[model samples]
Target: MSVRQTRKYTHKFHAPTTLKTDSIFYRIFQSLPSTFFELINQPASLAQAYQFSSVEVKQLAFRIDGVFLPNTSELPIYFAEVQFQPDKKFYSRLFAEIFNYLDKTELINNWGGVVIFPNRSVDTGATERYTELLNSPRVTRIYLDELTAIAASSIGIEAVKLIIEPESTATTKAIEIVNSARQQIIDAAQQREIIQLIETILIYKLPRLSREEMGKMFGLNELKQTRFYQEVFAEGKLEGKLEGKEEGKLETIPQLLALGLSIQQIAQALGLDEQVVRQAAQPKL
Candidate 1:
């Protein structure tokens, strides 16, 4: 019997803390700190005076995904966390970590926090104890579903919203962001970075797609040349088990379809003819 192992997110101090979406959020904040402020209804100009960095609370059970440190002592430090999984103690634990970090640093600045959730539902509602803090402006909880609430004029903000877009329309939105990023971002290197960021988001959202297909979809000749895309493609190995029996491959048609893969793509990945994949997609008589 084959045992299926499920990867569960944990709060331990030393586990594999790299989440699928964590790095994407981290990059967006570091490259575009202005977008981080915009997410919390702050003026984009505030970013000009702050530098962002990820913090690790030494020997602690938690980590701050990102922190915005002000150049001057006048502004408070803001920490950011991307929480997709539901952990009832998330907020409490975050507070502990933030305090721990503050204790270590000699800088005497006030601090605030931001947590990004997919929506209101994913956030555990065990906040009765911290009602004052929760209601205060210091803690900003962002619900990604309500994209309209965000004044998404900047390309960075646009990329952040694109991460949570519905699958049916995500491709169209990704393409639009790519075009916008290319046209808006002046530097060639920055343009490629933003475009690659968008591509990375789509890859995480739609893992079933192969690199070739993704390149064609984005219409970028340099996409496949990017190191991130190559690494992700190798890890996913959509065409793994090339030697498996035809019947086994046939059984995967429905699963692939459910993952938003087209019949042609499925057949190509499985090394089977399109006709056979099409036939497998039909209802069994």
Candidate 2:
């Protein structure tokens, strides 16, 4: 029987993690460390979950997506702000929260900053307070589009391409990526994950593709017919049956042998050694 497939997300398609959006962010930070945030005391490392508090009494907090602790053995922490959208109040809220966190943490030392925008145009209407700060040596702002000229040099070209692709184009590109990755990845589990990611990115781009159509694009139907898939399922159903009877033990022996296990090896599998397996192998003797 054919299973009916359903499309996952029907509304508000934000870029999903399966699209490797977060990984793209990390790649950017890795390549342009100075542009996003200074390394501070962190020597070539990215802080995934950073913690900071604003006021001791209020307990203000900021959980930065990425942080670069000072490398020269400094207490001041450098925080990275990666913004994929054009939020007019982006800087306003960012500094307010960071300062609040500083107060709460009682962190009194040199601090560095970075703010990344998808493109130069997205840097809209910064407050005068932030304007001065943006100009400060301690803070750096990066525009991903501005760096497109260097796309060839980019380690995250796939991610950069994702930003530029239209919905239709994205689906096509995603299919190609999924196909390429499908061949490149040898591990079945990992290949499955990437295939799922491909589907997710597509669904995130176009909510209209029905799950059935999506399955066709990713070749899921073809995968279901593989011998490996059938065997795993068939074995799963027989698990309990195989565990119960003495006949089941006799039955398991030849199957194990058919699977290239020697009698001794099959004996080991059933928790019996050479002698027990040999006796089980003999009929009525």
Candidate 3:
């Protein structure tokens, strides 16, 4: 008898902290593109005139966490970087990605850069070499910890601040944000999205807590009892049953991939195995 051989496969289950933070920022930008302009102290109206996206430099093998492209040729494009950890060579890498993007695109427009940090403590990246660029108006650095004073009035800004909130008080802050969302946001879907975002931020902040525990801490139980929640939950259940089909789930992989969801997030949201999602996400010849 001939000996049989089998292939072995290894799977990467979790996303790194940096990737998670990037995803959160991506979601915030997607749901509320205005928030980016708000953080940079620009007119929030500008967000309506621009579309946000994540860009990849295929040849150079670099990916920008986020980019805002203007609808007209007059406005400058913005490159956004969310740096939660310290990296000495961050500017070197950032400028490389920015210039490469400029070379690759045919669009002719001025450009700017925005770097977001939790606080000045983690903004340890060396800027000596790029001091001129850093000092120019083209670059904006936002520290989340310094924005707490404005969080009370702005739901989007409050959500951003929650990312750096301390463990002991994160839950309380989350509840306050949720309540504020209910009162301020008249749209039911928007309200749910804000609440869901708050839940997600807490999940990243308190990794040790189970989803059930986090849900309770955020008053999800009470929120779920609301009419809007019931409607959304019921619609979700119906959609889940329909998408439960293998073909339906496969069709969704590309859409989620386009939205910049990580394999882990796509798997969790679609009720599919990570390896399966990975395989589906791979490009075909």
Highest-lDDT candidate: 3
The window of 10 residues in a row where model 2 has the poorest summed lDDT is 1-10
Ranking by TM-score: 1, 3, 2
Instruction: Tell me each candidate's RMSD, in Å, in order.
Output: 10.3, 13.2, 15.3
TM-scores for candidates 1 onward, in order = 0.70, 0.48, 0.68
Residue 203, candidate 2: alpha-carbon lDDT: 51
Q: Model 2 RMSD to the real structure?
A: 13.2
What tens digits encode model 2's per-residue C-alpha lDDT throughout 1-285? 000123211111144323434444454444334323222323322433333221222332224445555434355576666565566766776776566555666446677766656667767746677667878877777665565454233213444455446775776776676676556657776556555544444555565665335434544233333333245446554345346665666655544444444676566556556786776666653
What would you estimate as the lDDT of candidate 1? 0.71
- Compared with the true structure, model 3 gives a TM-score of 0.68
Q: Write the per-residue lDDT of candidate 3 for residues 1-285, one digit (tens) a residue.
A: 000124211211122232256668778888888889899888877899999986765666655558998999999999888777777877887787788889998899999999888788878888889999999999998888798666434778878878877779888898888889888888877877887788777756766654335434444334454343454455565356435897788776765555345677668777889999999998988
lDDT against the true structure, per candidate, is 0.71, 0.51, 0.72
lDDT of candidate 3?
0.72
Total residue pair clashes for candidate 2? 15
